[model samples]
Target: MASLELRNVNKRYGQGQADTLKNINLSIDSGEFLILVGPSGCGKSTLMNCIAGLENISGGEILVEDQPISGMSPKDRDIAMVFQSYALYPTMSVRDNIAFGLKMRKVPQARIDEEVERVAKLLQIEHLLHRKPSQLSGGQQQRVAMGRALARRPKIYLFDEPLSNLDAKLRVEMRTEIKLMHQRLKTTTVYVTHDQIEAMTLGDKVAVMKDGIIQQFATPQEIYNSPANLFVASFIGSPPMNFIPLRLQRQGARWVAVLDSGQDRYELPLSVEDGQSLEGREVILGIRPEQITAANEGGPALRAEVQVVEPTGPDTLVFVSLNEVKVCCRLAPDAAPRAGESLALQFDPDRVLLFDANTGERLSKAPEHIPAGQSGNIAQFAAR
Candidate 1:
C-alpha cells in the first residue's frame, strides 16, 4: 500500500474559469481509508478524478509515496478505481473481467486464473465466476468490479460511490464487506460518497468539501462533535444539527443565550469567555437532536409546546419552537410525547455549540473550556 498526498491541487476546465478544485491539500496514510464527502457538484468527483489521473490538475502536485505523479498517465499511477456505474463489460464472464487488468499487464495465464479465483472467493462470488455481467444482480456486479480492482493489487484503491446503485439493504451489506476486505488487505483507499453514513462509518479520516474547497478535514467524530463551520455542522448529521438564531446576553460574568418558547424564556449557558464583543451579537445555538432530551427530575428544563412528533422506530423526533425557530429533539420512543402536549426539554450545556450567524463559522475558541456560572439565574435554570 502507498501513502497519497495532494499539495495545493487546483483544477479548472478553462483558463479563466473558476477552479473546480481549489488549493486542495490532503494526505492519506498507508493502509488508511480516507473519505471525501459532499453533496452533488461539490467537486468530490473531480478531486477523485484528479487523484486517479483521469483529469489533469490545473495547479500544484499529486504525489503517491512521496513521488510526484502529476505528469504520469492514469495507467502509470498505480491506482485502481471502481466507478459508480460498476463499468463491468457486459459480455465478459466474471472471471475474465476480474483477470482483464492482470492480463493487460502481461501476467501469466496461470497467475491470472489464480488471482481471479482468489478474489472471487474473497468477494464471496466464486459461484458466479462464469456468469456475464448481465446475468448478475447490481450488488453482484459491484463485487465483480471490486474484484477486478483487487486482482491488480494496485498501490491504492479509489471507490467512487461504489454502492450508490445498490438497494438499501444491499448497500449496508456491501459496506460491511468492503470494510472487512480492507481490514484483510490493509490497502490505502480513497472513497468518495455523498452518503454521510458511509462517510462516517467507512473512513479513518473524512474531508468535507463544498464548492471546490475543503471545509473540514478530521476524524469522523471530530467532524461531528466539533465542526469548523456551520456548513460542516449542518451537512454531517443525519437529522442535521438544530440551529436556533438568537442574540447573546451577558448575565454577570457569563455569556448566555436566551431562548423563548412562547410560554417562557430559558437561559442556556455558553462556554465563551466573558466579553462585550459577543454580548448582544446575533449567533446561532447549534445543538444536535440527540443532545436535547426529556428533562431529568429537577434538571434544567425548557417548557416547549410540541409541534410535531415523528416516530422513527427506535427513536422519536420531537419538534418544538425555541426563539421562534423550530428545533428537533431526539428522544427515546417510550418517553416521546405527542403533538400539542406541553413538555419540559433539557439540553446538555457542555455539548452546546455556538456559531456566528452571519459568517456561519464557529464562535468558540479551540480547546474550549466551560467556566463556572456567575449568576443565580443560570443556577435556577439549571435546577428547573
Candidate 2:
C-alpha cells in the first residue's frame, strides 16, 4: 500500500472560467479508507478521473508515496479503479476478465490462475468463473469488475459508487462485504458516493465537497458531531439537521431565543458567555431531530402542534412548526403523538447551536447565563 496526496489539484474542462476541481488538497495515509461525498454535479467523478490518471489535472500535482505521478500513465500508476458502470470485456469469461491485468503484466500462467481463483472465492464468484459477462446479472458483473481489480495487489484502490446500481437490500449486503474486505486487506482506498448513509458507514475519513471545493475532511464521528460550518452540518446527516430562525434579545443580563410555535411562546435561555456576543440580533438556531425528545424527568419542555408523525420502524419522527420554520423531533416509537395533537417536546439547551442567519456561520462565543449542562435562559450550543 502507498499514501496518496493531491496538492492544490485543479481541473478545468475549458477556458470558460469554471473549474471542475478547484485547488483541491488532500492526503490519504497508506491503508486508509477515504470517502468523497457530495450532491450530483459537484465534480466528484471529475476528481476521481483525475486521480486515476484518466483526466490530466490542469494544475497541481498528484503524488504516490511522496513521488510525483501527475505525468505518469494510468498503466504505470499502479492503481486499480472500479467504476459505477461495470466496464467488463463482453468476450471474456469471468476468470479471463479477472486475469486480464496479470496477462498484460506477463505473469506466469500458473500464478495468474492462482490469483484469479483466489479473488473469485473472495468475491463469491468462484461458481461463475467459466461464465461470460453476458450471462451474469448486474451485481455479478459488478463483482467481476471488482475481481478484475482485486486480482492484482496495487498501490491503491478507487471505487466510484460501485454498489449504486444494486437494489437496496443488495446494496446493504455489499456495503458490509466491502467493509470486511477492506479490514482484511488493509489497502489504501478512496471511494465516491452520493448516499449519506454510505458516506457515514463506509469511510474511515470523509471529505464533504460542493461546487468543486471540499467543505470538511474528518473522521465520520467528528464530521457528524463537530461540523466546521453550516454546509457540513446539513450535508452529512440523515433527514438533515434542522435550522430555525429566531430573534435574539437581551433579557436582563442574558440573551434569550424567543421561540413561538404559533401555539405557545417560550424563552429558551442561553449561556451568558454565548449570549454576550448577541445582545439584540436575529440568528439561526440549529438542532438535530434526535436532540429533541419526549418529556423526561426534569427536562425543559415546549408545547407545539404536531403537523405529522412518521414511524420508520426503528424510531418515530415528528414534524412541527417552530417560529414559522418546520422543525423535526425524533422520539421513541411508543411515545409518538398523533397529527393535529399538541405535544410537549423536551430539548437539552446545551445541544442547541446558534448561527448567523445571513451567512449561516456558527457563533464561537457561548452564553454565560446558561449552565454547562442544561439551560433555562437561552439555548446554547447545538450538538452536531
Candidate 3:
C-alpha cells in the first residue's frame, strides 16, 4: 500500500471548452479508504481517471508514496482499477481472467496460481473458477473484476462505482463485502460513488465534490454535523436538511427566531456566539428532519396540524406546515399523530444551524466536533 497525493490538479478537454476538473488537491494516507462522491458531471470520475493515468492532467502533479507519477504511463503507474462495467473476458474462465494480469506481467506460473487461489477464496468465488463471465451473475462478475485487480497487488486500488449496476439488496451485500475486503487487505484505496450510503459507511475520509470542485474533505461525521456550506449539507444527508427561511430578531438581550404555525407564534431562542449580532437579519435555519421531534418540551413549542404521516418500519415521518413551508419530523412510530391532528413540535436550539439565504454559506457557528461513533447533541427542550 502507498499514500496518494494530488496537488493543484486540473483537467480540460480543449482550449475553448471549460475545465472538466478544477484545481483539486487531496492527500490519502497508506491503507486508507477514501471516497469521492457527488452528483453526475461533478468530475469525480475525471479525477479517478487522472490518478490511474487514463487521463493526463492539464496542470499539477500526482504522487504515490511521495514520488511523482504524473508523467508515467497507465501500465507504469501500477494502479489497479475495478470498473463499473466489470470488463471481463467472455471466453475466459474465472481463473484465467484472474490470472490474465499476472500473465501480462510475466509472473511465474506457480505464483500466479497461488494469487488466483488466494483472491478467489477472499472473494468467495472459488466454486466458479471454471465458469466463464457469461455464466456469472452481475455481483459475481464484479467480484472477478475486483479479484483481477487484487491479484495485481498494485500500490493503489481504484473502484469506479463497481456496484452501480447491481440490485439494491445485492449492492448492500457487496458494500459489506468490499468494506470487509478493505479491512483484511488494508490496501490504500480511492473509491468513487454517487451513493450517499456508500459515502457515509465505506470511507475513512470522504470528499464531497460538485461542479468540478471539492466542496468538503473530512470524516463522514464531521461532514454531517458541521457542513462548511449549504450545498454540502443538502447533498450528504439522506432525507436532507430542512431550510427554513426567516429573519432573526433580538428579543431584548438574546436572539430569537419567531415561527408562525398559522395558529400560534413561537419564539425559538438561539445561541449566537462571538458577539455576532444577527438581529433583523434574514437567514436560513438548517435543521435535520430527525432534529425536529413530536415530544412536547417546554422551551418553545409550535402547534401545527399534521398534514401527513408515513410509517417507515422503525421510524414514522410526520409532516406539518410551518411559516407556509412543509416541514417533516421524524418521530417514534408509537408517538406519531394522524393527519389533521394538532401536535406540539419542539426544536433543539443548540443543534439548529444557520446559513446565508442568498450565498448558501454557513452563517451560524458549527457545533462542536462530534466524536466518531457518538450520538448527536441532547435537546434542551424539557417537558413541561
Segments of candidate 3 deviating more than 4 angstroms: 297-299, 364-384
Ranked candidates, highest TM-score first: 1, 3, 2
Reference-based lDDT, each prediction: 0.88, 0.84, 0.87
* Model 3: lowest-lDDT 10 consecutive positions: 375-384
Residue runs of model 1 more than 4 Å from their true location after superposition:
366-384
Q: What ranges in model 2 sit over 4 Å off?
A: 251-254, 271-276, 365-384
Candidate 2: worst 10 consecutive residues by lDDT? 375-384
Count clashes in each candidate, considering only residues at least 3 apart in sequence or on different chains. 0, 24, 0
Q: 1-384, model 1: which lDDT tens digit per residue? A: 999999989999998888898888889899999999999999999999999999999999999999999999999998999999999988898988999899889999999988988898888999999999999999999999999999999999999999999999999999998998889999999999999999999999899888888887877887888777788899999899999988888888787888889997789987775443886788888999999999998987999999999999999999999988899999999998989999899888788888888877776542444222211111211221
Q: Find the number of clashing residue pairs for candidate 3.
A: 0
Best by TM-score: 1
TM-score of predicted structure 1: 0.94
Q: lDDT at 373 for candidate 1?
A: 29
Residue range 70-107, candidate 3, lDDT tens digits? 99999999999999898999889999999998999999
